[model samples]
Target: MNSRYLTPLTIMSLAWLSACTPTRVSNQVSIDSPAQWQHAANAQSAETADLKTWWQGFNDPLLNELIDKALAANHDLKIATARVREANAMVTGAEAALYPSLDFSLSGGREKRIDRIVGVPSGQGIKLITPTADAVSGGLAARWEIDLFGGRHLEAEAAAAQAEGSQEGLHAAQVGLLAQVATNYLELRGVQQRTGILQRNIELQRERLRTLQVFLKAGLANEADMVRQQTLLQSTEATLPVLTNAKQNLIHRLGVLLGEPPENLENRLAGVGPLPKATPTMPNLLPSDLLVQRPDLRLAQSEVSAAAASLGSARADLYPKLVVSASGGVGALAVGGFPSLAESVYALGSGLSAPIFNAGRIRAHIAAADARLDQVAANYELTFLLALEDVENAFVAHRSARDRFSQLTEAEGSAEKAYRLVDAMYQRGAGDYLVVLDAQRSKLAVSDERAKAETAVSVAMVSLYRAFGGGWTIHSGIDKASIR
Candidate 1:
């Protein structure tokens, strides 16, 4: 029998004929993690993040609209979604490699010249060859490569892993985009609040200037005092334009985030709004949960899986490749002065190819694939470490900001009380206008700090939510399988 007719059992039994790598691929890779988070001090609450629109906890309707628009229209996210579709197609193509392929062809041609012939006809005079001949032929061919080592199946698995990784990458992008939007929105609000504080303080300083002018007229104030109050009033007014410019720039950033032109969102967000109020602590965040909650980590792990399956596919290349092909056709030749006969033709074949020697090229391929697996495994481990660091940093920073905000809020209240008392004393002629002016400045400074601290806490919370990799769960249909 021809060597091509050898069955897989015979081939494996004759392993001394060629090199064979181990066919078994293990799915085991270890990552050690802690049981609980170390920075869960202020986050003692049991409230979990609302997986279905985590931003809604802010209770800002415009924020909700912006997030919805970003998810629907963000161009980077749309490109990531397209990558997922491409991965899905690759999986289908890999699966197609396991099945037989059929193709068809047809041809017709005319030949005008006939060469001199010397052969005699059987039991008759020599027959004259035709000067013009018409020929027609049609054929059907089928080919199949028998995957004796499951290489094609492993390639399909790798494609599926790539598809899963693409999905996690999309989710991570959504998480990042949400975090950016939240940060910009809260900052815009904070700048507006500070600008408002400055405007109000400017008005108070102007009133004090008016009072100073009356004092000068009554021989109780000097020219220096009137000029001093005027200077303070104008100085306080100077900061508003800078703050207003920053706020408008933040609005433009938000407009682009929502996939709109910069000029389109000014009217809608023109009115100043208060900063987002900090909500109760999100619950159920632990170190071990980061493995599942972080989409970037999930993507890294999926990439590792793909690399492993691809390594298996490359290893399979060390063995023989077997292919079977067959073709069948009908042909007819017609001469202008003679009858012609139609004939049936057929052919069958099988091919077995093994890399006998190629200067270790196949081995190099397997080595390269194994190296990729190692690279992805390292990346997966680093991603886990980064995930832990992100959650811990967010927790500590948020708790510190929350605590600091509380202290500044108390200070703001005290400062406001002092300002009111000084104003009352000035009205009854018991306090100097300079004293009232100093008290007002103190109050404004504390109020601005408090607003900034509030915005910081809000932004910190957004960072924590982003670290927790809350699922968007928007299935593009092909991403049904959970990441392994």
Candidate 2:
């Protein structure tokens, strides 16, 4: 049989053998288990519409801009993108294993030598000079590892799956950055609003203290009353600096997220208004959507797929590997004064290698692959369950904060009216200073609570978006643009 035919024949036999026993495990887990996500009767129905551009629903231009900046420049996100690129390169390398590798070389050299005859009696004691000789050679060589055992295919598949997982990991990183930016921005604004409220209340308390001092001098109020009012005013004034400092810290964090110096944002945001209001209604993302939307969960799924492919590759290693090799070359040479001679040569070869003994290493590899696959399978399920829990928790938080915000809004209105009424009554000496002070404290408390509630709602919405895996998709048909 021709040597060239051996590789193909061996590959065919190995492929036939592999097909005889399809190596696989039946314990692969499903992407989602319906039993785990049973819906409650009173559960708010999640939106069925795809939330591809969920961030736009917030309707805040500043938030939209911040998210864009973070996606473009966040350090962790860039690292994740690099990982995806690396994975893609690995896939290309793995695929190259399936095709023949060809190389070519060309060379030319010249050499001169003085000939000395020692054995020839006639040439003894005589020095002979030889003309310089030149030679040229060229050759092409080819090698191919025939994937008779499906090892190369499995490797390529695993690499491709890993590439996909890396892409999803980038998406996950982006989603996380978006959530952080949104949450921080909301917090900054919340702190700003509270600071503004505190400042105003401090000014009001100062005015009240002045009034009390004046009344004390006029014998309308005692010195003890004046001191009590002064103490209350000082307490309110003390909180202003702490809240201001916290707001500045958040601004610095936002600056880092935007990939700029922290001090740079201070000037731009010096006169900026408070954080934008919360969206009117929170997004309702269903549990089922988490599977398709969340990048982390998708990444976990890809890992499971890669692990399965690895198991295939390990099983393939138990079979023989077939290889085909070919080489062709031409050379020229000169001897003494004779005419130059030229020769050409060509050759083809094939090989088969099987692991007959390795102390059960092959079996151990298969078992290890299987164990890894099992681990990823469990991780995938856990990721899904965690995502569901996040959604549930976000839903509960959003609803609770919304309800609390409504109550605080009402309480703030009532407190404002009560403060006005109490102030009027105190001026007419019909109400005590204690009533005025109590009303002022109530108003400040209600204002602070309302601000907190607003921030809570915004943060909860961000959590929901994250749990649903929002902001990684583009409407464009190109798949690369869809990845972060």
Question: Would you list the clashing residue pairs of candidate 2?
Answer: none
Candidate lDDT values, in order:
0.80, 0.77
Cα misplacement distance, residue 361 of candidate 1 (Å): 1.7
Residue range 159-232, candidate 2, lDDT tens digits: 99899889988888887788888888888878888888888788778877888888878888899877887898
Please provide, for model 1 over 1-484, each residue's C-alpha lDDT reduced to its tens digit, 9 standing for 90 to 100: 6656665556345432223324436544577776678888533323233554677888888888888888898887998999999988988998898778999999999887647333436558876554578999999999877777767778888899899999888888888888888889888888888888888888888888888899999999999989988987788788888998998899999987888897888888788788766453464665655666677877887888899889888888887887778999999998776689799999988789987888988899899988998899889888888888988898898989999999999999999999999999999999987798789889988998998899889888888888877636534322213323
Question: How close to the true structure is residue 262 of candidate 1, measured as C-alpha lDDT?
Answer: 74
- Number of residue pairs clashing in candidate 2, backbone atoms closer than 3 angstroms, sequence gap of 3 or more or interchain: 0
Q: After superposition, how far is residue 335 of candidate 2 from its true place, in Å?
A: 2.2
What lDDT score goes with residue 244 in model 1? 84
TM-score against native, each model: 0.87, 0.86
Best candidate, TM-score: 1
Candidate 1: deviation at residue 200, Å? Answer: 0.9
Pick out the ten consecutive residues of candidate 1 with the lowest summed lDDT: 475-484
Candidate 1 Cα misplacement greater than 4 A, ranges = 1-24, 42-49, 113-130, 213-235, 278-281, 474-484
| Per-residue lDDT value at 164 in model 2 | 85
